[model samples]
Target: MGLKKDYAALADQDRERIQRWSVLDEGEQAAILGDLISSPEMEALVDEALAANPDLQQTLLTLRIRQVQYRKTFGDRLPEIKGGYTAGKEEDTDPSYTGSLSIGWEVDLWRKLADESRAAGKDAAQQQALYQSARDTLGAEVMKAWLELIATQKNITIEKKRLGVLEKNEAFILGRYKNGLGTLEDLDSARTRTASSRASLEEYRENLARQRRALNSLLGREAGPALTLPADYPTVVPPLISLPAQTLKRRPDLKAAYLAIEAESLRASAAYKALLPSIDLEAAFEDVADTPGAALLTDPVWSVLAGLTAPLYQGGKLRAAAEISGMETAKAYQAYRETLLDAVNEVEDAVGQEQALKKQVRHINTALASARSNRLQYREKYRAGLAGMLDLLNVQEQTYDLEQQLNNLIHERLVNRIDLGLALGLGVKQ
Candidate 1:
């Protein structure tokens, strides 16, 4: 439990203990999401999923259950009251009516009840944080799927245009072979490339269909028609803004982890307090009358009682229970630390990936410009009969490949920006 205490202090350095938890409503949540997804359609889709998604709804239900459980635990601190009524006739006694009432309570001399109640409260708070985390994660997931669908559509377009170019070149090669200006080998190679390009276009189409289905599922619907989108990808990608380390506390997963540590610590305290002696007080009243109305209005007897209970011998079970709770507390602390480390690593990795992908896209753009210029020169040489058909085709293939590569890199950079925003805890909570 010493480790648990130490980790709790580390967690507290970033933020105060979670007591009363609240989440931003959909409107406010949308504002946070705009940082990563600015499209109105995407925003609307996220809102739809938040409202209709079954998994998210389940998490919310679990949070409410936890809240109810906390209230039950809190009720344990109050006195318990019971009432009973009876009517009977014995062989040697007159018909009688009776009523009894009793009240009992355990005095929390060692704050054991308080500890257990607080622990239950913390459990509820932990679930609330987890619910928010699920929500934030769902929003990011929907946006990622939308981004994938857009990129896939654009990729299919690039492949279709490429197929068109290959088919045009294949026809030119056939004409050259018919006139004895090109070898049969050159004609066959051109046809092979054209066929491969056509196959690739089909593959891209299949991928597009699958991506649409995935996005449809996220929208809480069965697969249907392809979603409508703009003819082009958005030109604007959100900037990579830096955030302070403390921003990690805003992440609901981290908040849940922190709450778990506190909850376990409180449970451990309550378990150890169970070893101490406890005091219980009880009071009862009972009345017997020949008539029901007399029983209700008059009491014939009254009694009061107090009891002290101590665990003198229980096969060391109480001590073992306390020890187990302590170990669990320590385990909870370790989990929190692990989560904290992962959060930091995720942020660093996303930032590094964004920077790396940007450099790659820049370098690819430069290479594409050079390759396109080389294709132009090769085309000129072929027209003057200075370069063979194979040489011209090879350069053309290289230029087309570079164009596709550039398209992929640009899409990848955009996706990385989404990851970066999520890592920095943007849109998670306010």
Candidate 2:
């Protein structure tokens, strides 16, 4: 028990949140999740999730590593310097001493280093875009769970109210049976109807628990209390909709795929550059003295040489590497195309759902109103013996079904609204 907390604290100390939710103790997880559920809005919870998600943080760390790689490749442009001292006592000579300095620079006559650095920098940018994409997706999922939890809560309330009505009617039917005004079948049907309502209420409660657990998981904690959403939380579909300009710029995943292409192209160019001869300028100085302590080498005793190295033979490995890089660049383009298509599909589907759900809500609201009215008339008819037990039960079931469907429609409209925002690439920053 103590070890779990110790491990969680240790993981929290890491620069990158690499540990999974398993690191958290069950009680600690519940406490943290309860606070998120108590918040006024899901935005705060979404921010916490994105900030605390270990996978997202690891992606950022990976980005930083790529930046370091860029620096190392660019640093190759700087000169390489070394120095050494030698002292020895020979049998035929006094203490002999020597000091030396050497410098070598590639001069980079062709921009090979620059190309490699550019590729590395672009990869870092791509990872950055991917991280933002993850943030956008996480926020959308949180909102969706919030919507489901709210709808389930409302449905439970509705079910309880309906249960109250059924139980009250059952009591009235029992009194009528005692007076010989209603048949045994009618009394039994009322009791059966009340029992069904109870069962429905239990089902709603179970679903509510499931939704709460899902919300907690997104917050990277154990399941906790049910979260209540505000009444005004975007359930109605918006009237205005417009196609965004330069849509590709909005999606981070698409941008990352595009950056991959350019980065790979630069890398391919650098690979070809590797096949050419490399020219380096070398300079060195040496000094000798009779004593162990010798003066350092100076310009007065120095030599310089311009060296060239050509890849004369490598069993075609160099050529193969260059070819592989070119193929990777081509593959990047295909990935970019695939990502673009997926982005387009997501946007269209979100838009379609928003449109369809908005119309469905209005139509369902009308049907629900009619169902409520019809059920009221049937209840009265059954009490007076004009309607049969089966007829009353059928009407009651229909009314309950309509009420539940209405709840689902409202939730769907709200969820689709959130999905549209994510599909348009809003709410996430890179």
**How well does candidate 1 match the true structure in TM-score terms?**
0.91
TM-score of each: 0.91, 0.81
- Structure candidate 2, residue pairs in collision: none
lDDT (Cα, tens digit) per residue for candidate 2, span 1-430 = 0011222122223312222111101111111112223344776777767777666677778878888887887787789899988887879878867888899899776788888888888988898888778777877687788778878888887788789878887888789889988789878888888998899899989988877877787887665555656654442333223234434566688778878877888888888888988999999888887754545553227899998988999999988998888888777777776776676666678777766776898998898899889988998997687987668777877887788888888788767656655655565433
| Deviation from native of the Cα of residue 405 in model 2, angstroms | 1.0
Residue 334 in candidate 2, Cα distance off native in Å: 0.8
Write down the lDDT of every candidate, Cα atoms only: 0.79, 0.71
Best model number under lDDT = 1
**In candidate 1, what are the lDDT values of residues 239-300, reduced to their tens digit?**
34444444566777888999999998888989999999999999988998999988973855
Q: Top TM-score: which candidate number?
A: 1
